[model samples]
Target: MLGRPVSLIEADDASNVDTAIKAATKLVKDDRVDFLMGTFNGDVAIAVSEFAKQENRLFMVTGAHIMDLTGSRCNSHTFVFMPNARMMAQAVVPHIVKAYGNKWFMITADTVDGKAALQAMTEALKAQGGDVVGSVTTAFGATDFTAPLMEAKNAKPGAVILNLYGWDLVHALKAYTKLELAKEKIGVGGMIGGEQIGRPLGYANNAGVWGLIWDPKINTEGSKRFIQGVIDKYNHTPTSRCYHGYAAMMQVLEAVRRAGTTDTAAVIKALEGHEFDGLKEGRSYFRAWDHQHVQDVLVGEAYGKELGLGHYKILATVPGDAVAGGVEQNQCRL
Candidate 1:
């Protein structure tokens, strides 16, 4: 896209903030990379973003969902490609309230990302006239959810929100299934889930109405093409995480092409307020003020068995504009 050969250098951040900053420094000073992308942890992403700003490099966050990245900590050098906790909560909370109930309980991982999800979901639920009856925080990677799940069940909430991701989410779902919480008429869900979590948890244990970043069932031509491309190369269906990496990189490269140079300032200007094919059914764009990627957020219900290409049956495709708060609401000065 820059009209010259580009070299990609990747370094594992080890999900640690210091490691991420050190790796980013090497990529900038040693590898001399012009742009940085990809970090899943909110803390790591934020750290790398600060580094990017100091070093004058563009960093595209692919997986982190913390709102601060595009809110209080927002900077011109950093762009978030994944939906934030607020967006996902606003998109799914209404559906969850309607399908499950107004009273909810939460088992949240005690990290910035998890706390963001807890707050977003709580606010979104309260906005819908719902309330969080109870909540408990667990360590970020806690394996045993017995205490929190039991406490949640004792509260007898109409639904439970698992504000977690990765294996933490997987293990929580397993414990929920083991407890047979659904049989008691208690619904469960969270801010995000898809093939990445479901594949590991398996269909039998994957239950609830959850937010999905992307699913194979989306019928858009771009979605079809992206899915096919992944299948061709990886021989496996692409997950939401896969889509985040691909889409974020595509946008960055496209911005570089439009700017006709890899100059950081020009690329940032090219990306701000830019609209593109999100590979989903919605108008996707980076809000000029916050640089958050606004797109469709899918609400899906997990079944005991697979339906089509995934475990979740899509329930709603909420438009980005319908849920993404206005610039004033986002509190982003830039």
Candidate 2:
């Protein structure tokens, strides 16, 4: 690694598409950064990618999982390092069906990404001979989920799949507890839930089958070392977003190193269809067809509280190639 200092430009005003584009444009016009990254918002991510292509700068999607990010909306300047909604549904639905039952009730976040995930999950269920018993859509930042939780409780489906993330997920879990849904022995699953919401509640409350994009405790030498290094540096455990950021940075660095220059085109060439080690998933690579990172999707169980932060007992390791859809499924032209 070079000793040269890497400058960081923070964009606190990235709440909307217009603001996100403006912040990125300012960085390229003023600081002249080699590339750009981030934006957890799906619409904002698409706007930023358009900026990247127009500016001839590479952009790595470190967060956000709108299927279109790597599907119809993908571009030459954008590469997605995180799994998308479709991948999440395919990886977790089978496990949910086997563990719980065929009937499901979905309480989904009201957003484009949320809608896409719901559709993908619905298709997965149909393919597996499972069925959706009932469903409800809620606003993105709604604080109270009592009404929906009560409705879902009465429906009495075999399980409830939360198509929620971030604060929405936390709110729904607390409401689920307060409403005494757990007393009925009904199970809860999530298409996009992780340690950010689970750790605070501990295993006893968060216990169940769930999908995870990454885990710091995966059994591998590289995984253990990477997890330890983060703890040593940050004095805390890593979240799924932390793992996503790390993997994206690592890929960028590797591309630059292999390309032997910071030129965007060369770096992009170096990354696509290239396999590499160091990820917790024994191996990983960016698909040339769509720029989606192909790696294992983990299904884990939290049976007890002592598993600790960033820890979960693996229920299954869904193969990356098997889960990452093929070219027929890929819509990206680039």
Candidate 3:
């Protein structure tokens, strides 16, 4: 997109904040990378954002949804590509309220990301006159969900919101199905859910309506092409992580083109408030106040193959502005 030779450098933070900071700082100090991207979860992302601020280098966040990234922890050098926790809650909770009732049970991973997402969802649900009936916190990698599911079953929430991800989400959903929570009229949802969960479990097993950043089948020319391209290259549907990488690359390349240089200040200036097409969403921009990208989100319901729907079907298209809340909603002062 920049129409020029671009260099790439990569590192593994091993999911540790201190390791991430050390590794990122080395890249910036050695002048080996023009910009940095990533840290899978929120705690490491916050540390990496601090590193970008101290070093005065660009850090484009790829996958980390903690509200603080673009909220209180936001910095001029850090721009976020993916939606934050609040955005995820806004994208899915209202629908959950309308369809599944206001009473909810929360199963959260005990991490900053998990807690932040749960808080966001709680606030959104409360705004709709909904409330949490029960809650459970789990260690991030724990596979057994029997205890939590049993607690949720006893609580008899109208819905179960899993503020869990990766293998945690996978295991919980499988257990939820095994226990037949749906038979008790207990619906399932999550702050974040994706093909990662749906693809493996199949729609019948994966019962819920949830928020998603992007879906290959979303009705957009750019999204269709992006999905097809990934299929051709990877021989599988792209994950939300892949979408984040593609979106971040597009934004950074566009910023470089507009700035005409790799200077951090110039690129940052170019990106702030700049709007463009090509995102899976119709159009998106970097909000100048918080450096969070504003874009639409998908609300999808898991549907079985028997229903003639692929893994999940889009239920609503929540506009970015509708879900973005406002500057007042953000804790970022700059």
Model 3 RMSD in Å is 1.9
Clashing residue pairs in candidate 1 (N, C-alpha, C atoms within 3 angstroms): none
- Number of the top candidate by lDDT? 1
TM-score rank order: 1, 2, 3
Better of 1 and 2 by TM-score: 1
How well does candidate 2 match the true structure in TM-score terms? 0.95
lDDT of each: 0.91, 0.81, 0.85
lDDT digits (tens) for residues 248-316 of candidate 2: 888888898898888999999999999876366646888888888888888887554546555567778
Per-residue lDDT of model 1, residues 221-317, tens digit only: 9999999999999999999989998898889889989999999999999999999999999999998889999999999999878687778899999
- Model 2 global lDDT (CA atoms, 0 to 1): 0.81
Error at 104, model 2, angstroms: 0.8
Clashes of each: 0, 0, 0
Runs with alpha carbons beyond 4 Å of true place in candidate 2: 1-3, 308-311
TM-scores of the models, in the given order?
0.98, 0.95, 0.94
